[model samples]
Target: MKNKSIFLLVLTLFVIALAACSASGAESSSSESNASESNANSNSNEVIDIVWYPNESGNDMKASRDEIGAIITEVTGKEVEHHLTTDYAIAIETLINNNADLAFMGAVGYVEAKNGNDAIEPVVVPSGASGTLDDAIYHSWLAVDVDKQDDFKVDGEFSLDTLVDKRMSFVSNSSTSGFVVPTSTIIDYFADSSDYGDLTPEDLMEGGSLFSQVLFGNSHQGSAVNLINGNADVAAFCDNCVENYVEAADGEENTVGTVYRVKEGAAEPFNNVIGEEFILISVTPVLNAPIAANLEVLGEEDFKKIQDALASDATANNEEVFVPEDSDASGLFYKTDQERFIPVEDAWFNPIRELSN
Candidate 1:
C-alpha cells in the first residue's frame, strides 16, 4: 500500500513537469512566428519589373537587373524582380498593350510605341548631350569628304542639292538617326520643287537615295568606314556618333572625323566650299517611346517605385554603364517635351515612320 502511494505521487509530479516543458516550447514558437510575420509585412511595400536587361553591345544583363532590383527592394521595401525579352520590339509592343511593366526602346521605336499608346511618359535622354540645338534636337545633316569640303562653301549650314548624284552611304533602314530621319528629311527637301530628285531607301540601297550608289554599311560606323575606305563618296551619320571616330582614334588620325560639330541645322548653302566642314545630322525624339509601366499591371505606387529604383544612387551607381559616359545621366534625363525630351508628336516622325512602315 505504501509503495503504491509513492508510485502515484511520482507519476503525478512527472505529468506536471512534462506539461510545463510543453507550455514553454509553445510560447517560444508563437513568439518566433509572430516576429517572422512582422518582418514580412514590413517588406510588402512595392514591386517593379523590367522587360529586358538593356543588354545592347553584349553586356552582362543579369548584373544590371540585380542592381535595379536591390535598389527598389531597399528604398520601397518591396520585393523586386527581373524579366528578359528576346524581342526588343515585342517588348515595346507589350508595354503599349499594357502587357509589361516598363521598357527601353530606341529613338524611332519609341515613336511607334507612343503613337500606339499615350499613357506612358518620357523620363530621360542621354547624359552626354548638352541639350543644345541650333534648330531641332535631332537634325538631318549631309557630309561630303573632308577632302571635298573645299567644294562647298559651308561655314555652318549646308544644302541637300550639293550631292545629287554622288555616291552616298547611310545606316541601314532600321536606324532612326541614321537611316529613317535623314531619308525623310531628304524626301521633304525634294518635295518643294527641289533641284535634287526624290529618293528612296530602296534607291539608296540600290545606289539611289537622291544620289547614286547605295553602300549599306548597315551601321553608323559602317557608313563612316565606307567613307574613309573610299567605298562611298558621301555619308550620312548621326551628329552624336561622328565624335566616336575621333574618340576611338584618341587624336591619332583615324578615318572617323574630318569634322567635329554639335549640330547641323536647317538646309542652307555652304558659302565657302574651300576648307568647309562636312554636315552632320543631329536627331531628337519625334516619337520617344518612354519607359512606360503598364498601369493596368503595375499599380501607381509600384510604377513610381520602378522609376525611383532606376535613378536611385544605390542602383544607378551600381548599374554598369554599358557605354559609360564621363558625366552622370541622372539630371540629363527627364520626362518633358522640349526641356529634356518633349512630345515631338508622331506626326513629326511620320515622314520617317511612313517609310519604315
Candidate 2:
C-alpha cells in the first residue's frame, strides 16, 4: 500500500513538471513574438528620407516632392525628409549605402543601384494615361537649334545620318533617356554602315571620329541649355524633364521635327536660354521612371505600407501629385483621366538591362 501511494506521488510530480515545461515554452514563444512585433513597430516609426535625382531637385519640384512626402507620412505616421541632389551618382550612392531610405530614379539609375546593392528594389512606377503599363512611357529626344534643323535632312526627310562629326551634349552617362537609349539607337542605326558597322556606345562617349566634341550636361535641363547656347550641335534630353520649362513652338508634340522653346520666365539654367528653340531630330519612347526603395532599411512591413499607399486611389487623385493640364500647379506627375501609380517587379526593367548586354 505504501509502495502504491509512492507511485501515485511520483506520477503526480511528473505531471506537474510536464505542465511547468509547457508553460515555460509558451512564455518563451509569446516573448519571441512580442519582440518581433516590437522590432517591426520601431522600424515602421522610423523617419524615411527620400533622395531625388538632379533632374527633379530644383525648387520648381518642391511642391511635387512635398505632396508625395505628405502621402507617405500620412500612411506610415513617420516624418519624411527630402534630400535633393545635384548629381545622379550622389543620389544613387546615397540609396545604395542606406543613407537614404528611398530614391526616385530612371531605369538606368535603378539598374545601377540594384547592381550595386541587391537590397534595393523597385516599389512603384507612375502608369500611363490609360492607368496601365500599356502607355506608361516618356520620350528621349535628339534635338538641335531650329535654325540648323534643315541641316539634318536627307532627300527631304530628317535623318540621324548627319549626327556624325557633330558636337553633342548628353545629360549624363548614367541617364537612361539622356544617354543609354539615345546611344543604343545611334549604335543600331549605324550598325549596317560600311564605315561605322562596328560602332559602339563607348566610341561615342568622347569626341573623336564620331563627334567633334562631347559634353556632359549633368542634367536634362542642362543638356537643353547646351544646345540653345550653341555649345553643342545636337543634345539629348527627355520630354518630361523639360516640359514644365518649355512650350511647344512648332510641329506635333513628341514627333520628330517638333520644335520646343523655353518659356518667357523660365527658371535659371533655362532662364538664359528663354525664347530659344530646339527641334527634335530623333524621338524614342522609354519606360517611365520608378520610386525605388532599400528593402533592408525599410523593412518588409513598412515597405508594404508605403507601397500600398503609393498605389492607392488617394495618390492617384491628388492634384499636387498628378497635376492637371489646365492647372498651374508645378508638380512631377501629369494627371490623365485614368493615370495612377502601379506596382512593378524587378523584371519590368529587363529591357533597360538588355541595353547593356
Candidate 3:
C-alpha cells in the first residue's frame, strides 16, 4: 500500500510538470508570432513622403497634402505623408535632396522647379483642360458688385479702358488668377500699356498709377467679398469664385441680394473669362505636381510597387483623402493614365491665347 501511494504521487507530479511545460511552450510560440506580426505590420505601413507648394496660401496646399497622403496610403498598403513647403523654392530643393518623393506645384513654382532641377517633370494636368499646352486652359473673372455697378457695362464690352482710373482690387500678389496672370492678360489686351494695363499690384501706392488705387483681399473669397461689400470698383479672381457668388446670391434669406454678371460672353465658370462660350488661352498652364520615388531609397522594384499601389486604390477616392468641400468639389479625381507625368517641354495647352485673354 505504501509503494502504490508513492507511485501515484510521483505520477501525479510528472503529469503536472508536463502540463506546465506544454502551456509555457504554447505561450512562447504565441509571443514569437506576435513579434513577427508587429514587424510585418510596421513594414507594410512604411510609405513615401511628398510635399506641395502653398500656391493659394498654405490652406489649399495643406488640403492637397492631406488628401494625397490618404490616397497613397490606401492604394499602396504603405504609408504616405504630404507636407506643405514653407518656401516654394525650398520645396523643390527638398525633392532634389531626396527628402521627398513627390510635390505639387503652381505655374511660377513649376517654372522655377523646371528651370532649377533636371529630375522635374510634368506628371499630370487638370481633367477639363482643352489641350496639353501651358495657357488658355483656365481663366479668371473680373467683376464688381451689383450694388456698385448697377448694370454699368464699362462701355458694354470687356474693356479695361473704363477701368483706366477706377480703384481696383486683386486677390493677392501671389495669386495666379488674382494678380499675375490677369495682370499679364490685361497688359497684353490693351496693347497700349499706357493705362490700366501698365498698372500692377506692386504699385499699391494708392493713386500712384492708372488704377486710381489698389487693394488686396488676401484670398479669392475675400476678393469677391470685397467686391460685394463695395470695397473696390473691380475684383479680378478665379472664375469658379464668381460662381459661388452667384449661387450665394440665389439664396432665400442669405442671398447677397445681387445680380452681377460679366461682360456678356466673358462670364466665367460658365461662359469662360471673356464671357465667351468657349474662350481658349495659352496662358500659364495650371501645373500638376508629381509623385516621384527615389531609386536610392526604395529601389526600382519597391518604387514601382509603391507607385502601382497608389495608382490602384490609394488615389483621390479613398475616404481618408482630405479633399475640400469645394475643391473638385463635385466628385472629380485624376486618373492614372491621365496622371502620367509628361515633360514640361512636352506640355501643349489648348488656348486661343490672344482671343481669350
The candidate scoring highest on lDDT is: 2
| Superposed model 1: Cα runs more than 4 Å off | 1-101, 116-123, 126-141, 151-158, 172-174, 194-206, 215-219, 241-301, 311-357
Query: Over the stretch 1-357, how does candidate 3's per-residue lDDT look in tens digits?
Result: 322213323333332221100000000000111111112222222645555443322332334345545444444555655544444455556555555555554444444454455555433333222222222123455665544443434554334456667777776554556666556555555555554445443554345565677777755556655665566777765643344224423323211222343334322223333321111111222223334433443445545444443433234234323233343432123232322222222222111121112
- Arrange candidates, best TM-score first: 2, 3, 1
Tell me the tens digit of each residue's lDDT in model 2 across 206-324.
99858889998999989989999999999999999998899889989999888898988888788777898989988888778989999888778767777887787777887878899
- Of 2 and 3, which scores higher on TM-score? 2
Question: Candidate 2, clashing residue pairs?
Answer: none
When sorted by lDDT, best at the front, the candidate numbers are 2, 1, 3
Local lDDT at 240 for model 2: 93
TM-score: model 3 vs. ground truth: 0.52
TM-score of 1: 0.50
TM-score for each candidate, following the candidate numbering = 0.50, 0.86, 0.52
Global local distance difference test of model 2: 0.79
* True-vs-predicted CA distance for residue 271, candidate 1, Å: 35
Off by over 4 Å in 3: 1-47, 52-67, 74-78, 84-101, 129-136, 150-152, 193-207, 240-357
Quantify all predictions' global Cα lDDT against the true fold.
Answer: 0.43, 0.79, 0.42
